[model samples]
Target: MAYVLQSDQRGIRTLTLDRPEQRNALSDALVTEVDAALEGAGADPDVRAVQLTHTGTTFCAGADLRNPPDPHALVALMRRIVALDKPVVARVTGHVRAGGLGLLASCDISAGGPGSTFALTEARIGVAPAVISLPLLPRLDRAAAARYFLTGEKFGPEEAARIGLLTLAGEDVDTALAPVLDGLRRGSPQGLAESKRLVTATVLAAFDRDGDDLVERSARLFASADAREGMTAFLERRDAAWVW
Candidate 1:
């Protein structure tokens, strides 16, 4: 089954996450599909904007824990999103967690419904949000990142917006996203490409400088005994042995 559905309308290309049964988890296959789609959109002259959304109630549940993705591939996917020349807008109407938060942060603009929730959940699995931190740390407020990264607490869209994780939060995410997409569609392709470069320069630089180390860190943690036990316990629907 296809993990991502792609369609183009006007000047916008929309890539809908289609793995609702998995809550749109970022499995290796899904990440590879998304990367290919983004690359295709970036290279298409007719595509002026990209809209990212999901089919399920949960936007993305992060990596599929049962078949955890390759950390290097995850890093490459995030880098592709950040480096895509066209403006990428995330229309979020569902929950985002762990690596999903990294996906959201990489977009140029992200609009989410008021009920949408978010969290950096890796800590609960005894692994840090290492690869994701490349994009997320730059986008999130330092203090907010510290709190959520440490606690793995769920928060609503308002706090997500306030902390710079989202560009807009409203009762209706698509409604809020329309004007932003329209604005993106109106810009000349060159103008939008250059402007996005100006905005994402720092993020790209961070990826260049630290992406390898972060990927290594993530791989090491996932290989650790604690992370394996925590992930296993999570899948088994029980507290990890270390949890007291």
Candidate 2:
């Protein structure tokens, strides 16, 4: 089965994450598929915007521990979303964690249902959210980022919105997105592209300046003894060695 399902309507291209069994985790193949889908959407003249959503109660569980993609690939994916000329909007209905939040941050707009939950959980896995921080740190509230990054706490959609991780949260994601999508539809491609470029300049700059360093940091952390133990414990359904 395809890792991503794509459809276009009313100048909006919707890309649905299809790995419900894996909570749409960003495995190597999934990352590659998503990047290619985004590239196609950007090149399509009929596509004025891109909508990213997922299938299942968990929107994305960050990385697949068993098949994590290259840190550089993950960084590139996030950068592509920010740099894409058309607006990229996230319509989230479940939970998002770790690297998944990076995707949210890279989008031009993000709306989550009230049922959605979010977290930056890399610290718990004995690694920092290094590559993702390129997008996240620039977009998120500093205090909120520090708190969740250190504690690895899960927060609701309201809090995610309050901290700039989401544009809005509502009881129904599609209903909330109606006006936003309409606005995007009404915008001329050039107007929307220029507007997006203005807003995402800082984020793209972050990727340009710090991306390589962060990818190296991420790879090093994932290879460390602590991360190995943490990943193993998580896969085994147990606490890491330092967990009390």
Candidate 3:
């Protein structure tokens, strides 16, 4: 079964995450599919931009604990979104958590509806939001990042925009995204690519410099005794042992 559904209209390629039953979690297969779709959009001359959206109420529930992708592969995917010559925009109107925020941060622009809620949940699961911080820390408000990354508290779309996790938030995601999509469609191929580079340079630099270290850190954390207990507690619908 296809994990990603792809279509193109008016020079914009749309990639929809299709694992609704899984809350569109980032399984290895889904990550690979998304990466390959992005590659196709990047190479197609007629594709002026990419719009990444998803089906279901949870845009992504972070990594699939049962079948998480390699940390290196996840990092590479985030970097690819940042470095893709064409602009990438995320249209979200659902819950996003943990590593899913990393995906949102990597995009050039992201718009979410009022229904959207976000959280950096890794800390609650006995791991730091390490690899994701490559794209997240570069763009998020420092104080905001510290607060959410450590506390794992959920916030609304408005707060997500205020903290730089979302470019815009509105009552309707498509309404907010229409103008941005129009802008992309109007931009010349060279114009969009060059302009995107100017905005994403810092993010790409973070990926290049810290990517390897973060991947190792993430792998170590996931393998730790604490993470094992936390994940086990999560799967069992209970608080982790550390929670009082």
Candidate 4:
């Protein structure tokens, strides 16, 4: 099967990640497909909104560091999504972390199942939040994000909604997404597109203005031994002594 699958229903385009055995981790190929899928949905007049989802237990486990992704590539795609002229909603069902959190935050809306928890583990991996921070900022006020970003702590569904990272935390994402989708469907498609445009333009312009510095800073953190150790420890099923 393909790394990513794109399907459209009633003008809603859903891009699903197909790499489950690997915890739906983002490989370069998957990232490429993500970019392409977003590009196609953004351009399709019939697609009034884009829904991002995945198959399997782990919604996404971040980057497949064995082959690791170029942070810039995924970051750039996020800028595109934030700037796109349509609403993007994330339908999450399971564990989501790191770059996966970036994808979720980039979406204008997110609905998660009861089991969902969101975390940013870059610092734990000896890396900075980078692009994930960019999307996370506008929604989660700076202070809360800073604490979560630095600690690599996992927060649950209600906390996610309280933090503004998730719009709905229901027993199942489908129930929450249903009403939100209907609301969007009721609006003028042109108006919805334009509203998205205005929001994206504002956010993307700001991102462009300060994005480089942040990315560079994150790169420096990524080179740290702690980040490498933490990631390695997690993969090896051991505790990470961040104090060391």
Q: Say which candidate scores most in lDDT.
A: 3
On lDDT, the stronger of 1 and 3 is: 3
Error of 1 at 228 (Å): 1.2
lDDT of 3 by residue, 118-208 (tens): 9998888899999999999988899998999999999999999998889999998898899999999999999998998988887788788
| Alpha-carbon runs more than 4 Å astray in model 4 | 241-244
Best first by TM-score, ranked: 3, 2, 1, 4
lDDT of each: 0.91, 0.92, 0.93, 0.83
Across 69-141, the per-residue lDDT of candidate 4 in tens digits comes to 7778878878878988889988999999888888888889899998787788777666777767788788885
Residue 2 lDDT (model 4):
77
Q: How far is 36's C-alpha from truth in model 2 (Å)?
A: 0.5
TM-score of each: 0.98, 0.99, 0.99, 0.92
Candidate 2 residue-pair clash tally? 0
Q: Which ten residues in a row are the worst by lDDT in model 2?
A: 131-140
**In every candidate, how many clashes are there?**
0, 0, 0, 2
Evaluation by lDDT, superior candidate among 2 and 4: 2
Give per-residue CA lDDT, model 1, range 1-244, as digits (tens).
7899999989999999999999999998999999999999999999999999999798999999867678888888888989998989999999999999998888899999976999898889899999999999888899999999999999999999999999999998888988888898789998998999999999999999998998888889999999989898889989989887
- Give the distance in Å from residue 42's predicted Cα in candidate 2 to where it truly belongs: 0.6
Candidate 4 TM-score, C-alpha based: 0.92
